[model samples]
Target chain A: MKLATPRRLILPGLAVAVIAGLLSLLAYPFPDALEDSLESHRPETKAAEEAGPRPSSEGSEGWSAPLPDYSVPGVKSEGLGGALAGILGATGTFLALLLLLHVLKGRGRRGPNG
Target chain B: MHIPDGILAPHVWVPLAATGAGAVAVSARAARKRLAEESVPLVGLMGAFVFALQMVNFPIAAGVSDHVVGAGLLAVTFGPGIAVLCMAAVVTIQALVFGDGGIAALGANVVNMAVLSTLTAWAVHQALRPAFPNLAVAVSTVLGVLVGAGGAAAWVMLSQPYGAKFLGAMMVTHLVSGLVEAAVTLAVVKALRASGLVPGDARVVAR
Candidate 1:
């Protein structure tokens, strides 16, 4: 089989895109895994958390660490999920477009073969 | 740099999406103008080849695995417009089917990896083509890979929260990946050229 045929190429591309999209959707709901993976080596955050609170001097304001707030609006953990969805969606669109364009061009080039 | 959702604020993603859409549109139009029926299959095949190449991940420092982001390679093999189209397709597939990048950040990813890298590589090819006509293929391949990886690193630094370590990590990982991609691209181009699959004229292949 020739590697350059549109019919042969589209199926695999579509299959991959669909599988990736589904996986992303499944991964979206879980946030903790992503955060933990991305932040496993935050030395600064670890150091700050470990050190005791420091008192402020008379002239200088006292050092106070902000409270940990996870309530920021629209913030969600779905890192892997989002990436998967975006890639699949875009890939599907691209493959479909390529197939359509190829068919159209093929038709224009040859009456029956196209 | 497949940035997942929640990494970037919505404001950043939205604008990047718009920019990416515009760039893709322009590239499609350009491709339509230059492409012939015979070239279509080659472009599509190259896209698949890129997808396959991306799957072969090489080990970066520690246990992290990085793969080829073939924006530069595509541009060198095809033209910038076709390369952009091909990469956009690859990235889309990677994001949707593989969960490699976030859906919301698709636009940013395309812009950074596809548009920026292809255009940069093309520009470098144009500049160096005159001086090193014989080495155009190798030079273009190297430039494309380096610029594409560099563009991704830059985008990650700018879009995400500021931190030198983060940027440094991205750059280091991608730089190694880029070199590997460059070597692969050079080998492919050389083989194609030697086999008579690619014509002597660079512009002809690009068209």
Candidate 2:
């Protein structure tokens, strides 16, 4: 079997990444389900805690993401930072998956479906 | 759902990490054995596509919004093992790089979003495609989202005292989100077929 190249998919993949990056700018700016629920229940949880001791809500206290909340560092514009993060994430995912698959394929005997 | 860090207890995430790692390893082996060398690019592209799609969240209710998980789409396209790998990669990136999800909760997110969702969707599609080819994907997509959401809720429940109210709300919100997910997945799958991105002779499931 011949070694495979993604020549045909390159353009389409780039198109998808670019489109996704642009669309990310339009992503809804609202808390997701878990966060929303937690936020809504916060006051009640606080009141209950005032009444009795409870476990802390801190799962990983003092931890910060490299790109916290998907925004780029020192980016003046929130939209621009988010969009850039989206593009970076999409491109990174593509390369990471490609690399992982390549490693796996390299380890096995080459075949038509390997 | 990207459960942020500091939500799940160590007792919950640690075991899930082990299980998720084991599952990923197994899926990697299966995908390596069955995936066509030529199809490698498709998997990568799909993974990227899924990651991008996740950024766009649709408002399903007055105050609830959720994005397309895309596990159902990948599972229906490339079978469970490959779909799992692609989703695991996407989720890992979202957690580690984007910080959309908790680093400690990565395993739970992977198990919930990738493994459960893909396997459930694949199984549903395989079971129903023979009898109802047209509706199978749609049904499977919806069920996959529900199962994934349920898994997330269960994990959160085990770790926190979120209570049944949170679970109920999560399911209801995800029900609407699942419909949105189904429509998008169906459209994408149709486009993939129409564009001839996926080979006509190829049976994505068997592989």
Best by lDDT: 2
**B52-167 in candidate 1: lDDT tens per residue?**
55544555545566666677667776778778887887777666555556677678778877887778777876777778754665565555555555554455445444356654
lDDT of 2 by residue, B1-207 (tens): 878766677899999999899999999988888888788888888888998899988777666678989989988888888889999999998877777777788899999999998899989998988888658889899999999999888887776666778788778888888988999988888877766777422264226
DockQ of each: 0.06, 0.47
Q: Could you tell me every candidate's TM-score relative to the true structure? A: 0.67, 0.90
In order, candidate lDDTs are: 0.58, 0.80
lDDT of 1 at B103: 70
Q: Report the lDDT tens digits of candidate 1 across residue range A29-102.
A: 23221132245423355543343112112111232112111111243645443444345344544556469457
